[model samples]
Target: MHTTLLKDFSVSAAIAGFVTVLVGFTSSAVIVFQAAQAFDASPAEIGSWMGALGLGMGLTCIVLSLRYRVPVVTAWSTPGAAMLITTATGVPMEEAIGAFLISAVLITLCGFSGWFERAINRIPMSIAAGMLAGVLLRFGLDVFISMQTQFVMTFSMFCIYLIMRRFSPRYAVVTALILGILIAGSQGLLQIDTVRLQLAEPVLTTPRFSLSALIGVALPLFVVTMASQNVPGVAVIRASGYTVPISPLIGWTGATTLVLAPFGAFALNLAAITAAICMGREAHEDPARRYVAAIAAGVFYLIIGLFGGTVGSIFAAFPQELVLAIAGLALLGTIGNGLLTALIQEKEREPALITFLVTASGITLFSIGSAFWGLVAGGLAIAISQVKR
Candidate 1:
């Protein structure tokens, strides 16, 4: 592993890691903040939550990636946080913390029992690919949508991407990142004042368990994180053709969450969208070397954790168009590859297409996102087709 990192440390991989963190933080950090507020957490507690989550994610990513020698990226439960935003309101902060602990325990059990791993392993690769493609389809489209706001910046990045792709394939993303920053700065879109660097202090809260909190918040969070985040996360690994053990990965997340829940680590699970960024060929042409990107991401996440107080401002300082453009450009190849894989099998083509379309629709049913729904639709399609035969 040491040898691999020393020889395969590419600028593209590092940039990929940076881009993944930027997109993850800018896109969903607000939801996290809102969730914290719903629990009536003080500002200090919120900062602690950020620190705990950041440390959990960072440490997990580094340990798991190094252990497996695969890019086993872990993330805080984005969808789970969204769930809490609605369900956690009116609940006491103590109960909410209790709910978090309960959810963590449940997640850990799922991992230790190996039930979740078995279920994920059974998913058809075509459907898995379609689900991943569906999840990422929006980001891919955002690349072009960014043009309406930052035409010069978007077009310039796109052109540089094209030029670099033809000339220096490995550094295409790195070059685009540089060009995007330069263009954003030139246009005065960058806000320097919003960014204030400081250290974050963790605040611990004691959890008081309740049946109502368990049923209302804990169960829902656990279900959403598992169904929405971890499921697609497993698909990303398989879609990328890496065979890391899913059970232990899920188990470790649960364990980390259990230990850190007092500090606001609500739920930790395998990553879906952001993990794809690290797992893709753009991160490293040689799959074996891609773990470095995940490690790099872990380091950046640690920085975010230490400076949790400024995370919101720092990410906010970057123009929305830049974030959208960079994330879209970064995942372009992964989206295309997923779609192609989903559609390649003749018999599975229709089901895969249905999965992709449903997922891309962005519809929400029962507070669950379209990715899980897409899989359900694809499964029904396959089942009906098989029944006809």
Candidate 2:
């Protein structure tokens, strides 16, 4: 019955899932890896994170999609990963875990009380879109700049993506990945020696909850994860043409974070750019059938969890230019749409544009990343406009 509207459940869903995780993992898993390095995490602890992240994101997507019967794809919060990389560095692993616990508690409260959902709903969609666009602009720059070093391999795959997107847009990423691999292989850019399959060991870090850690780590983490990660994450979902319970998602991610905190899972929330890939029409033409793709993504995430070491190694083997090209290429559509949406409404246009520019400017104040500041600038713009109007 559902097939009539959606068609090819397992196959399409599997492809969608593969693309989602492949793209998602390739993009920011490194940040998480780096965070682990900062805290001197053991390989097993890192693997545990992969496992927990896989389980948390996979279970959430499966349940949410099944319950809502919408393609409610959940992602391991990208903003949180960025926050950890920037803010959690040098802090003891235990304190990081403590911060995670605190953030999770706060997150659970938000979900249960529904305060977060209400606040998020208040943000104008255009501003949200603008912020997303601003965040992606840096990535777009990397893609082009990479061409100077890896002109042949990166540009070749990029051209393939462009051509494929013009035709079989759904398979654009798959095609790019395959072609990039082949090109990289031909150029000896693929480093197979680094691929090592080892069981990931889980390291238990004792939580040392402290006021300083809470102020320095937890608050910033919660703020960025909620404002930058969850906010844009849900925006990606709604913008991609689906609706789900945001509060419950926050609750679920918080629950997962609480469960995995000891194992080095710092934070988990919905993903924005990565989620966009899975939720977009390119994932599947029929929005109704897209859950299959999300389920597929969950499965891929499970693979990531299972062979966290090997998978991370293999992805790490790829040329940075190759990853940069593919990521930038994949996000082009979402970026274009975000810019357009931000500037659409006349009253919101100036503020939205200002928000976009400020975000794209890559200004970092007080060691805080661009995501939080973009929201601040954008929100301030919106507030000023409302006062005048």
Candidate 3:
């Protein structure tokens, strides 16, 4: 498998892996920290969570991709982390861990029972694509919105991306990352001092279950992860024309999460936008060989896990504008693909558009995210249209 990855290796695939981790950690590591803080986790406990998550993601990405020979990248549930930022407060650390365990168990059951996979498969391709696009729309727009503050750096990165896209589309994101870093460095935007060299040790917290925490934290986390993260992840895989079984993957993630919950593995699931970096044509000319990109990402993830504290600092040192710019540039192709796919079926177009717009609105009601509502809205639209017909 190592030999296969080496033999099929391309610079594009390597860059894609680096870009995937860069975007993944940069965009959401802070949210994960906030989630940990909400549960009143000590510094050591919080660091442990980062380490556990990185290790889980690393192992899963490598194992799944190598075993299946597909680009089966996994990620810490970013949206789940975001949901935790708001919902975790007032929940005791022990109870939070209990909630995590419950959520993981539920996810595992859903995967093993095939209910989650079946329900996900029932979503039309247009609606799935619309949901994905809606989820990513903010990051895409942030590329431009960032220009207002860091005009020179963002503009330079954008120009470099354009130039690279024209000449070597596969490495455009790589070029943008490099240019963003260089520009940020030149402008003294990085906090190099904060990034100390160190390894992170995991701190386990005992779990204490509560019905309130189960319903408030566990159920909501489960729903947010499924609707906001896993759904888009499956959509990305299907859109990329991969035949990987979603149920087993989800089950494995849930199982992994369950084991590591005491150490802060909140949720681990398939990646959507970041996985696209590995699955894209740029990663490898032969779709079958693109698993190498995922493996590469796993390698980086392992490094991040082993040195969790340092890795967190490194990603933190990157300027917000730089991170946003690179993330947006990397996701441009994905966003375009999603929009194109969502609009392909004439009959489904309206509902899909509604889904897209609602998701893009970033609405939150009853502490549930817009992705769930968008799906509901689109499903309702489809049912109403069918009744009218």
Candidate 4:
């Protein structure tokens, strides 16, 4: 078993895993910290939040990927954290913990009941592909956008990426990342001094459930996590052509969240963006071997959980443009495939295009994200078109 695993490992896959963790943490860790602060959590408790989240994501990503031989990545629910920033303010920390528990229980019920998986399975592939393309369109654009400010670094990475793609496609993203890091380091853009090696300790908060907390915090957290995070997550998996069982994946994440909530794991769900990083061709030329990338990501997540402060600081030390450049470059292939699949079927083309546009528009209504709204719009379009037919 160990030899088989070693044979599957590749430098590109490991780099893909590192890039996934880097993007996931740098993009949203601050929001999670603020969510903890909103509930009047202490610094230690906030670190506990990071620790719990990291452990949950790490374990789920590793276990699920290995079990299914699919690149099943998991993450702290960024949308849930963002919602908590507003809704958790003035709520007692214990009550917030209670709400997290309630939300996790609800998610577990949905997953174990197989309802969420059934519903997601009904979403047409073209629509799912469109939503995914829309979801990732921004990241692809950012590769060039970064050049406006950090031309020397971003443009250098872009050129190197193109060159690598022409010669050694598997190493394009890795080359871009290495070149970006070197350029950032040479420019003194890497803030190495800010990184300190501090181990994270979990601080538990006892649950204090209330009807108001259930209505205000728990329900919204569950809704946002499902609609904004998990739905697109499932879409990404399907769009990438993986057929891993969805119910168990969702059930395990919810179960993990339930176990860790008292220690500040507010919500854990399937990761769309980060998962794409591990599922894309850049992770491995052979799709079957991509699971190793997720396993590598799990190891990184474990490191973050054990040394939450230090890992957080290390990700923070990276220059913003470098992160943006590498992420955008890495995702270029996935975005293109998503767009192509979305428009391939003539009957679904218009609806899929609408879904893509609506999602890329980035509009939010009633606190729900564009991904959900895009699905609704595409579904409605499909319905109307069928009626006409």
lDDT of 4 by residue, 80-175 (tens): 999999897578999999999999999999998999998998899999999999999999999999999999999999999999999998999999
The per-prediction tally of clashing pairs is: 0, 5, 0, 0
lDDT score, candidate 2, position 58? 76
Worst 10 residues of 1 by lDDT: 1-10
Candidate 2 overall lDDT versus native: 0.75
lDDT of 2 at 257: 81
Could you estimate the TM-score for every candidate?
0.98, 0.87, 0.93, 0.99
Residue 47, model 3: Cα distance from true site in angstroms: 1.1
| Off by more than 4 A, model 3 | 87-90
Q: Which residue pairs collide in model 4, if any?
A: none
lDDT of 4: 0.94
Off by over 4 Å in 4: none
- Better lDDT candidate (1, 2): 1
Error of 3 at 29 (Å): 1.6
For residues 124-194, write the lDDT of model 3, one tens digit per residue.
87887888888788888999999999999999999988998898887777778888888899889999989
Q: Which candidate wins on TM-score?
A: 4
**lDDT of the candidates, in the order given:** 0.89, 0.75, 0.87, 0.94
Candidate 2 per-residue C-alpha lDDT over 215-330 given as tens digits, one digit per residue, 9 for 90 to 100: 88888878777766787677777666577778888888888788878777677787776676666555666777777777677767767766776788777788878777776776
